[model samples]
Target: MSTATAIDADAAPWSPAQPVLEVRGLNVDYGAGRDAVRAVNEVTFTLRRGEVLGLAGESGSGKSTLAYAITRLLRAPGVITGGEVVFHQPSASGGPARTVDLLAADARELAGIRWVDLSMVFQSAMHALNPVARIEGQLTDVLKRHRPDMAPAERRARAIELLGMVGITPDRLSSYPHELSGGMRQRVMIAMALALEPSLVIMDEPTTALDVVTQREILDELMRLRERLGFAVIFITHDLSLLLELADTIAIMYAGQLVESAAAADLLAAPRHPYSLGLLNSFPALHGERVKMTGIPGSPPSLRAMPTGCKFHPRCPHAFERCSAEQPALLTPAGSRGKRTVACWLQTGDRVPPEPLGRPEGDRSQDLAVGGH
Candidate 1:
């Protein structure tokens, strides 16, 4: 949370191309000093206003850690060793924008910013909600806390409006979390997150446990809300195909580091990194002749025993002598057109990739992996 005012949906128009959140050289560790194990390594990315930036990777790729670190929600043994999370918030009353470093914000400052300027929807709806409290209380409690200037009747009306926006009727307000279906509960969580009209919403696998149909419905709702509210979203999930459709840009992480980042359409058409190609091939194509699902050869390296050079070199099919001996930095490819960047020797080094960086779109027969796993 930063000392930034909330953007008024009606008054202050959103600048979609402007940078809303910037994370630079962010590093997160699990413990202190000698016992520390790095979980998020020098991660850097910029999220533009009113954009959907999807973060995709394997289970242990530090996606969640990076999100928590960015929001200053890392707890206990988890520690942020370095970096800056700068938030650029527009003024509500036609004033100059306010900038603040979220990592340096005190508890009071954070309290003022959370739910007002920034909010989050966690992985599980059931786990995020209060089991004992009614939905009405849960929704209104946020307004009560953050908008102390508002009267009780106003909070109740806002709560009803929030639930309605998420497709929940006011009659269900008296029901407890357990009384609602899984989708309804998830909608409630989303409603609560949107109650204060936050500028950015971090959704960490919000639909993980639901059925595919429910997931689609929730995603559609999210897109509709994003359109209406003009809020940026950092959607963290492992489903590459889903990200292909839902995200404007996608960032792929591996072993606590970003291996590749590009526009969603570009990344889907051509992933530069070997690891990214492996992940894309692992999923069955949405519309094409059926192809066998192939997984990456090995599991992710443990945080404490990470391999030298590129962290993915051990499991990467394109790994070569240079990959094992020297680490690669994230950089634009020689003849690239846009902001696409990758951390792989094949793209960054003098040597070129084995084939054209990508296959023809919708053609799944030509996979990046040379051998079967």
Candidate 2:
């Protein structure tokens, strides 16, 4: 796997014009009534045009559910209880941009928007790809449906171009999914996602099973493609370290709710949430003085019988009286230096905050993530 020249996502100059997608108070439930468990609870975020927003958290954090809900891929048992998902798109008249509430779009409306304006790359490429169909067939199937007027020769050419963009050779287009390696399959998934030239791409841990070197190479290629295509991304994964390098901004999810959202640099330098700090500490640093690796204490709270007050109160090292008494709402406090939105009582600043033990405020998150790969 060969890596491409990469642009520093944080160092890039980005002018955020209008959000391409705005998800407001979106809630998803597994069942109905009392038995219902909220998989995504009032999750809110905005993805600026051509920006990469990373959603990071542990397993069962509802990142995948949020992706499915946004794409309207959630099945019957998974019902969206409330909130709005607005997608900003160019209008037919090419005047002011058009806005469509994805949550409210009917089946026909959604079908038209799905592959045309937005696309998703699922986690398991092996499972998502058709074992019977060759790569060329799968790639051209998208074009044939979306571009009915396209000639066969044109479709074949387009498929070849898509494969080349993802670092795959045109000759491999005839090979079946099983014939390709895991990394190659993942790249094919990415190519398929981009087949329709969607303005936004949602990827759900597409490189989780690949080796670190392969992961870096794939990410480099993906970033290279994004720069060329100018597509916004909503990348979902548990690796905050990867997001710190690849994403412009990151949002941390805990127990189906957003605990913190900030610019990647800001979050890495000064994380306000304890869970965020814990997650950063879980991964080992590739450079700098390496201490013993520490794991996050305990497990995520069970959604069925959610912990009262703060969901992470049970295992929070800095938990106090208020943590178990009242749930904290995501808020930006006075005198905050970063674009930090934290849901911890320690961050509210109204009350005297807990001291970070012996660690300096600026060094805490760094201690966890300094020189992290």
TM-score, each model?
A: 0.92, 0.91
lDDT of 2 by residue, 126-165 (tens): 9999999999999999999889999999999999999999
lDDT of 1 by residue, 76-168 (tens): 899999988987766666455566688888888778778888899998889899999999999989998988999989998998998888888
Q: Which candidate wins on TM-score?
A: 1
Reference-based lDDT, each prediction: 0.84, 0.85
Candidate 1's error at 362, in angstroms? 14
